[model samples]
Target: MLLPRPLLTLAALVAALAAPSVMAIPGAVVTTPQVRAELVAHAPEGLGPGRPMALGLLIRHQPGWHTYWKNPGDSGLPTTFAWTLPEGASAGDIRWPTPRRLPVGPLMNFGYDGTLLLPVPLTVAEGFKGERLDVTLHAEWLVCKEVCIPESGDFALSLPREQATAGQAEAFAAAEAAKPVPATGAQARARIDGQAVVVEVKGLPADWQGAALDVLPATAGALRNAAVPQASWSGAVWTARLEIDPQHTESPPALDLVLVRDGVPAGLEINAPVSGSWPAPADAATPAEPAATPAAPPADTSLGLALALAFGGGLLLNLMPCVFPVLSLKVLGFAAHAHDRAKLLAGGLAYTAGVVVSFVALAGLLLALRAGGEQLGWGFQLQQPGVVAALAALFTLIGLNLAGVFEFGSVLPSSWAAARARHPLVDSLLTGVLAVAVASPCTAPFMGASLGVAVTLPAPQALTIFAALGLGMAAPYLLASAWPRLAGALPRPGVWMAHFKVLMAFPMFATVVWLVWVLGQQAGIDGAAALLALLVALAFAAWAFGSRSLGVRARTGFGLLSLALFGATLAWALPAWREAPPAATAAAAETGWQPWSAERVAQALAEGKPVFVDFTAAWCVTCQVNKRTTLAREEVLAEFRARGVVLLRADWTRRDAAITAELARLGRSGVPVYALYAPGGGAPRVLSEILSPAEVRAMLAELPAVAAPA
Candidate 1:
């Protein structure tokens, strides 16, 4: 049934030629799931040969979706209109309406929701012989909720010449009201100051004084879309400090700005000229707003409360899935030194120091990167594919080591073994580091609020909060080491210890499996396969070096072979990791859970359906636990179905700026956030990080009648 390439193309062309042509109508309408678009026009004075015509593409969006403006801002394509007309007729550019700020995730877009009108002017040349004035338009636009969809329409309109046809007068009147007006007597100038742009405007009407003005850039890429403008007034001149987008470095000759006050639609337009020389580029991007804005923690949140929450969250972290794999290692270390109080105490302190230092260092680096304008949040390291691959390799080695594939001291030369023996505390410290590495991906309950506040605070305070979290995580072990009685209670070292250690290797291997899956979520299946191959080669390398059955000479040769095999595998794997495609989205239909989008949530609510959104990540152990146990239970699903609730999953395995922004808007900065939305449009009820089947059922049962099927 397969057709050849040339025949298939010819068949498609023949099918198109057979299709019926749509006739031109005065007001042509097209409807899609997201928008209802109409081409409306007016010829005020009956179409004279040289008279101009006003045509508008008016779109009415579905409850939750919106289309882009002339300057889409940050991420979307602007709506475009291509015209087809007779030889003597010409169409001008679309006169855009004043756009409103639509904040999506972390990015800010300039667009319109509900209804949009884009007006275009058409001119007819002298001596037009055609009896009818015909206009054909091919238009394209990107409509967005949380997700964006590209849509286009082809429209044809005809108006009889010499007959004045009254058109959609109301729509044209509204379009005129929504358009931007000239700032009659205002004068403005702009200058670059470091990474910031300073705009000074003078001679505005005296009545407009003292009102807070919202400044929007008419030129795309001129300013950071999400950045809050800093403005102050002095006498007749008003100065506003705005962040210049680092991606677009060179300033435009003239910065076009829209100034709005009191949520007005029609705004004053100012074209400001750049008057100063540009400064040398900085080595790194810097924050335009060095001080925290009002979005940070409120004054009521004391430093003590933040530290307390951080410490408590860290203590609970030990029980999270990400940290469970490391516990066995710690248990083995404790068993080896149960009877030796001095060594046990030393190891514990070393581990605690390791944990604290690592936490502080990671927090400091994250803070630095964020100050430099990176839209990052908790568990940032795992967001990098390279980092995930490295972690995979690391865990594989540890698992192989614990499985007795490699003996550090006996596997190789004596010098290496002696060095390891001399540095027992170093091993303990490294174990602590590994523990933090895994634990970082899990955001325990109290940790979210504490860390959210920490990021906005001064460096010293932020670090202190991080230090407190580490101390809490290390506290249980620290306490056990300090108490000789607890060590006495532990079973004495025996031959059974060896078996227990081997059993512990399974958890380490499990950790490796989890890490590979996490990488797959970030870099697709190819990346995961690469990491697996690398781990297999590494296992063989460990085996070749440590297998005592082989003679010394044979072992040396195989060791060399192992090294070469691993090197070759690594070379192949590295490229896969670097060139990997973005995380693959799972098919939503199969799981009965739609991918989360702000628009989807809004639409569902608008339809009177209760919504439950699971803000989760593959790397978070707690998220997986709640998902498999409570949320996935038959009872929970039945209840959801009974209540007509829509399930949405916001996957945070990969770095999503939109998801990050949503978390921030929800007053948290990390995942395992559960939001239950009732039918009506109000704040969704946030659930605890951990969930229970009983609690879920109770919440569902409590839904108002509106959410239940009528």
Candidate 2:
């Protein structure tokens, strides 16, 4: 029978006043001054013989330390309890109270800071209530602060069999009420715009601050503690742009968000939605869309302008360092066919068709992957080792071919060189394919905005944008092919053509070298060595094929050997794809240069230190040029140092998931992202992709005086 409220309250008061001593069970104390256990309770209050009673496992931690909850945020371990009860008795799960968020330098951990009461409910057997109830439990918990220590203990509780009064039940109920509650209506929706992971959360209270918010992963190895998440508040919504851990595997499981508002515990369980939709559909197309915006005149105008810009950007790409080599070759082909207008027109049209077809295929693949719930970005192709290795090999072979080391099929075997000179169409079509391939590495201006929109738009619209880009890229080549007079106006092919071709080979070789370097960054030194070996083998095979004395069999043998080498390399390199290491740039001491980390940047800004972050990639020629011509110069470094500027280098050489996410956080998807944190509290000053020395100096000069000496 349930006891009266007044009587239950009186019993609870007596128990509190008694302040019973906590005795350690046999083998319970693993370390000195700390007792660990599975169960603990007042002696006489235990269940009767053969009956189990509710028991509390009091984990009294060492001073300045504590244990953990099931979801250990940032750091710490959960306290596990294994029970061994007397015959006819059963034990219930432990009830855990809300934990406090512990900040250890750059990392955030969830754990108890002091003593904790873990109460476990026990079931008393029918007709077993008699004399005494004995229960045993084994428990383990991890305690930490800067460093971590794991501890374990065995504990037992004995209680008398009696009709438990209402007083005891009320006391236990109050303790249970203190347990931490999980956050409800917790949803994590993410949008991949450019290179950022803009994660939005709903059902959160207004004025949500970082201190009260903690992001926990529901699955193991989902989010890294080292990765910093920047939080912002807009009314009832809270958004956190977390640097997706590059080390984090793709398509991570659902994330658990623990929200503590003014110490009131709430929980949010969020899985990466299959697609970005409200009441997210199981078969949603993309992860999520950007927040809705009204259809304004500016929005339409901006999109039209973006399309125009994409066309212009595609045209400009033809002149880029990487694309120029193929363009020159195409020009040579056009010059040779200038006298034949029909052939010229056919060649141009064919080349344009190739460009459009390739672009359409790429767009289709990207969309298909998105439909299958994959997160992809503009330069996602470069993330694949096989792709990188193949491109490297192709460039090397092209270099050798252009240097007259080998020849393709020709009608006149006796005068193969003359035959090659006669057919400009072959070179023209190949050049078109080559241009698109090379242009993949360099993201031109206006391309990011367009591509970002394309990836999120319907398939047809996306393909149209892609086709427009292809048309722009093929425009110059098509013009030369369609108009013989224009082609004839150019210089005739001669020895200079050979020299130019040879010159172009160096650029191709340069591209190969850059790719190899990126491979090293992605797969580590061992992977890079393997790629290098593959390249050497390919070069040897080409040389063998070019040899005049080599028979068809011998040439085929060498070709097979090269293919085998590449296959072996791929076997080793593919699985080892990883983020590239941070860039190693020499900076003046005064600049207080440090490796780029989101936490460090936050701390620096909090401490009132101005920061300048250089987001660059080794494979980006523009980035390299900016580094050499501006940022790395002694004058610039010294000036930065003298002013106590904090220098942060965010390297995106290979496929860095974290840096990519960080870039996305800043509303960018590519490299050469520069942002300056100024003193006196203002938004960071964002610099353009192309930075001149004067531009860097001027930005520095405009900053306030250094608060601390370098």
Candidate 3:
């Protein structure tokens, strides 16, 4: 039966007014096959003004299904309670009890099963602003067994100032008994004992040899959740050992743990303050210490390891696509000084110096920009259209010279034929600089964590990391020049040098083409066309200047024309590039990927659907390659479809604050980050930048066997 708009509105208002008491019922409370949940206040006499009250949430789960804790160990989401309080009302933090470690094969989880009462404090203002309190809480939690379901509910209740015995005080009492007891006069410290982080506690019960001791870290992600935590009690002291997580980059200054004894509350939750240096990852010469002695340093924060990783990443960058054009330069430099040992060594050193200097300068600039509140990452310069266009022009000129279309002056005093050996420091230094300029657009696998930590570290340490990367990048050239044997292995310089040199020009041109495509993405089609026309004028200028017959006046005229064409191109291109097209994220438009937003991710998670996030940029060669070779495959598409996964791409080609924050949250500082979140309660599993279909298949196979949404 359909009614007129006004009549329907009036009827709804009447129905709502008639059933005001229905709000007291748990109609909007969430109930699933595995669990049922509700919200209840602990104020037996209705909440009074300026009084402290408690709220208890009753959650009951079917056998084998459970909800997570404040620290959900390995891979699970903590339960969340969001409230919309009436004026002058506030809610305190959730009081969490000690959780039991639930082992699932290789992974471990911390949570509660069966029935539980979760309590929180509700504080009313000193002077009540209103006659009644309209309290509303939105609860969201993940319930799981073999499969997990994300659920939420809206609950509201009204409390009048007049004291009324209407709240669940009994439930609150039960929760208080279940809560972990806070311990005083207790001091604890952590130390490295063999392969484990051992914590020793003082001021516990004497002769408590048989009582159980639990050391649970309040800081999630600091320790390995799957490892069985070992505990021992001796001589009125208790000791517990935990294995540190290898991937944890930063450590909390203080660790808080809830202690339990023999399935009973120890009345001793302690905040352990750190006072010692970090331990080495490798086994120290010192033997494993007794549990009572917790003075040995704990897991170390790696600086040398980070530097080594950075260097390795830089070495691998030479083979990445972005560095291909520079390879040709290296080849020419090599052939020119193949027989001169001193010149070769000098050139290599100069090149190495240039790379190191440039890397330091870039790192300084990046840090300065970050301090000034710019949301950016590595290869950020390429995000600017001006930088892209300038690089394109430089590559085009270099390509023309290599193709023999024009003759720039010799890199050394020797002529183009390289018949005589001569080396100039400026030329070698410039080669290193050019290599860095091109290499900035690419990020190899091992670079991520090193770069991520570099930004967060102090200035001097950060510079060291960047310097290490530069040294690695220059290793190949340095080795060839310093070691005559390596250089001697190359084929002797010959008449074929010209042919090889000319062939190298095509790669430079290809680099120019790629830059133009990137420009097109930054700008639009019209802007790209203008840039192409400008390139034509540039080519003409080069040809005119190189001509044997052209006089000075004619060359000058061509140069003027090129200058005018470039001016016109910039007039149109600059403005257009600044005006970016509506982005469909870093993923290409045809891949059916949606642009990422925190809201979108939250919404998808609330729906209990799986999500795959691709954090990438157009400047990242690895990102594009991975997209083409792995993520775009039909098999991957079928897998996604079968699992009902929502795909999102966080485009980092430009400055996106949210995306940068997300990257930092994931402990990454560069593009090509892939995160796969399963429908079950757990932290997202990160994938390698250089993705493989087999890895993706294996990741999917490990997920719980939940039925796909229809």
Per-model C-alpha lDDT, please? 0.77, 0.61, 0.72
TM-score winner between 1 and 3, please give it: 1
* Each candidate: RMSD: 15.2, 17.6, 16.0
- Writing each residue's lDDT as its tens digit, candidate 3 over 1-710 gives 11112333687667755652323533436566777887777665556655557765789889988888898765557888898887778888898756777765445678889887788888887677575677778887867665444566667766655555344566667667778776656668876544456787878655344576666667775676666678886766777878766444336666677776665632357776655554433321111110011112221465677889889988998888888788778888788788888988998999999888888888889889888977677778888877887888889988998888877642223364353324477778888888898796585465887777778777888889899999999998899899999888777788888898999999999998988887776666765676677677777777776654667887788768767876666666666665555433235465657776544554466577778888877778888888899888999877876777888887776556557756765667788889875543445677877799999888887655457668
lDDT rank, highest first? 1, 3, 2
Best by lDDT: 1
- Candidate 2, lDDT over the whole model: 0.61
* Top-TM-score candidate index: 1
* Per-prediction TM-score: 0.62, 0.57, 0.57
lDDT of 1 by residue, 1-710 (tens): 11122333687667644533322453378787789998877777756655656787989999988887788876566888998888887878888888888876445778888988898877877867787777888888878876665567778777666666555767777887878888889899999888788999998878777789998888875688779999999988999998877545456878999988876668889999986765543332222211111245553565789999888988988887678889778999999999999999999999999999999999999889878866677887887877887887877777877788877555748987787789889988988898888898785555776777788788999899899999999999999998999999999999999898888888888888899998887667888888888888888877877776777898799889889988877776766665435322662643668887665665666566778888888787778889899987887887788778889888877776657656755656677888886654445677887788888887887875334446
Where does candidate 2 stray beyond 4 Å? 1-298, 360-375, 410-430, 445-466, 491-504, 545-548, 552-592, 678-683, 707-710
Candidate scoring better on lDDT of 2 and 3? 3
Model 3 residue 437 lDDT? 83
Clashes of each: 0, 18, 4
